[model samples]
Target: MSSSAILDAHQTAQALPYLALTQEIEALLQDPTVAVPPRIVQALHGGGSLFVMPAADARVAITKLISFIPTNAQRGLPTIQGDIVVFDVQTGQRIGLLDGPTVTARRTAAVSLLAAQHLAPRRDGPMLIVGAGVQGRAHLEAFHEGLGVQEFWIASRSASSADALVAHARSLGLQAQRVDDPNAALADCPWVVSATPAQEVVLSAPPHSDAFVAAVGAFTPRMVEWSAPVCQHLARTGTLVVDTRDADHEAGDLLQAGIDVAALPTLADVVGQTARWQNAHRPQGGPVFFKSCGWGGWDLAAARCMAQGIAVSSAPQG
Candidate 1:
């Protein structure tokens, strides 16, 4: 028999192609008959977060519980940690445990890529990153691999972090550099992704002509990664896309801006209304805002991808 082992970060990273995952996500959502929506439970504090998300279909079920400790980075520990449990739908028996961070990173980036690409008029441009933390690195790799972005510009509050991210990108044979001026840098790139945990604005300038932005930062209502003015501009001038209707409860930037959640289109709306958007295309030189708070279905999708054709053990009981 083949060996059964827990999938760690390394193995999880290569378990699936993000492009395939994004494509599969579209295919799954486009089916009008599928009705299993992801269920999520969240607990949030000033510096800590815990989230439980479960998603399933007719054949499989997966649940992932993710946590965050902000001070872990100060102690030379990773800030985010989680575990995913998989089960067989037929028997309800435990089947797999996969690393949560890897799955989260992959699925988050794939979702961001999906929204950004869907909103963008054209996908060919230097991918710009507004933060150089772990999320930034994940998106860098995701956009490069999934969307064929060959050039990168990373701007961060911490110069060292930006340099480190740039080094990692260069190591992968990608042309990358640190942005000294975020405003000027933002004005020149098309796809800008904000992956920070900042309570303030990251982009000091409006996006370049015909640019698209994927905002993945700020979860709580107190945290505002995109400034109020920028958000107002986005609401006024651009189309806003969110991952789910949960934006009303979780997305701080959208909440702080007083945006009408009903007016904001979710990912499903984007797919379902693609033709209408194209037919009613306004002037082509506006910023596109895609805000994401993540979803449980993505974690399930990642788990299935990693568990494909593999054997995994049951959960250890005390």
Candidate 2:
């Protein structure tokens, strides 16, 4: 019998330098067959946080646990920290253990970029990003390195954080600026990303006519990032693509915004083939929103691709 290979966080980190984890994740997003079942999530009260665990595919199952703690500022540690366990589906054996927070940040940004690649307008334009935390920085890196963004507008409640993000983007050889107002930033950029965990509606007003919005925060029932008006605008004009409609209904952003749950289309509908649901339904103008509630299949696919790459790179030359 052959022994299974085991990988720890260090190995996973080393493998990232050689593998295109971002690109692999993007490919999986385009493939409809990948099975990303509903995620398993739990709320922890002491820290006022929630834990989300998602797993997918038996061939290479990857499980990630994400924590959201708003009060972590009182403590020295970060509010969000977790780990990912990669297993071989056929034999039910563990293969890799990854730094959960790092992978989550990378995968989340990659998924957003994939959505932009498919939904955003053809021409490149200024990009506006709300929130300047880990997700915000990851978005900047991914957009700068992968999306070829020309100019960036970074905004946060904290001006210093926003300025820091802008400077980091410049270090990466990209043109960036800091914005004090969310609405002003939205008005300037055609491509917008909201990565905040604000409980109340942040952008109460509707987006510009040509803007494409990607809402990556607010995964739980209590948290909301986008305002009701924005969701309604999306319903009126473009397609509201989501990882799952069930998850969206539970989100406070959509519920508080009073978005008609019945009107929004599921990822299944967009990826599925049927009458009256052709690809033409994809919005051409106005605000098109793609909300991800997190999927296990995406993680599994990414882990499998990474593992395969590692194996190939380790093989001896002929």
Candidate 3:
């Protein structure tokens, strides 16, 4: 695989540092040249889903093919597995391939971090992460490296997984612990990330007034992590933002709560008009909730970031 054009998970991650990826995502969100259509989702027989996501900018085009299998966790296999095929927009040539799961995890977390950068009430705090899966760990790392978070609290359905994530955080020289109940921990942790496969409400407690919550667990209309009360409270007293317009229908937490997502702002909207939005929301001094349901544009940012990284690494040293 060393000489292959397709980079493995580790290699793909190496090419996409959180800072670079975050900047790329922010830039692409505002670029009018980029075109990203809604992803194509096909239902699988075994309660799984196959997603075909495609996006293109002036320079390159990419398509990600991945499967989400909830049952894979039982078999000790990854829930997401596939590859992102990058092509040259000019020549229609296949340029490279990247591990899909890595792109999803890192890009999703990076998007959260980008939102937090603009919306979070405070930069450094005890961040509470719900769920101990891949997205959970990615959020922990993203907040730590991207925001200088020094403390963490993790809660999950599986205590062992939660403990493992806590240990990983500890290894990174951060204060971390596993909490039996996530709702109770929400009071002290001003920053919260819920990343579970939300068959049931995992976080119903209301966030603190100045808190920032990124709900990334539930993507479908049926899947949800936050309770109705939590979603409604955030909508009424705080600010509600979505990663993309597709979240209006696909974000389970918001949709199930009957949130008027069309009235909500998006990450692109905020990033495009940062100063005006900051001025408007700063006076309110309410919590910020960001709902993300995945988007093809994010995958496109990852592909562009990887291509730039490859070019930089292969350049001659002066």
Best by TM-score: 3
lDDT of 2 at 278: 66
Q: For residues 1-318, could you state the per-residue lDDT of candidate 1 as single tens digits?
A: 223347788877777578877876776567443334544545566667787777776655788888876667667777789888877677777766778888888888888888866778677778789888888998998898877899999989889999999999999999999997777887789888898866576665677767888888876666678877778887778777788776767788878878875556688777777654454345645788888887777776775665553533333446
Please write out the lDDT profile of model 3 over residues 1-318, one tens digit for every residue. Answer: 123267999999898999899999999998899999889999999899999999999988999999999889999999999999998888787878999999999999999999999888877679999999999999999988899999999999999999999999999999999899888988887899999987888888898788999999999999999999889988788888899989888988888888887767789889888653554364567888989999999999999998887777778999
Q: Model-by-model lDDT, in order?
A: 0.76, 0.68, 0.90
Query: What TM-score would each prediction reach against the true structure?
Result: 0.88, 0.86, 0.96
Q: Candidate 3, which segments miss by more than 4 Å at Cα?
A: 1-4, 274-282
RMSD from true fold, candidate 3: 2.2
Instruction: Please give, for residues 58-138, the per-residue lDDT of candidate 2 as tens digits.
Output: 356667776767767447566577777777677777766677666666677776776676667643787888988878887
Sort order, lDDT high to low: 3, 1, 2
Query: So what's the TM-score on candidate 3?
Result: 0.96
Model 3, residue 261: distance off in Å is 0.6
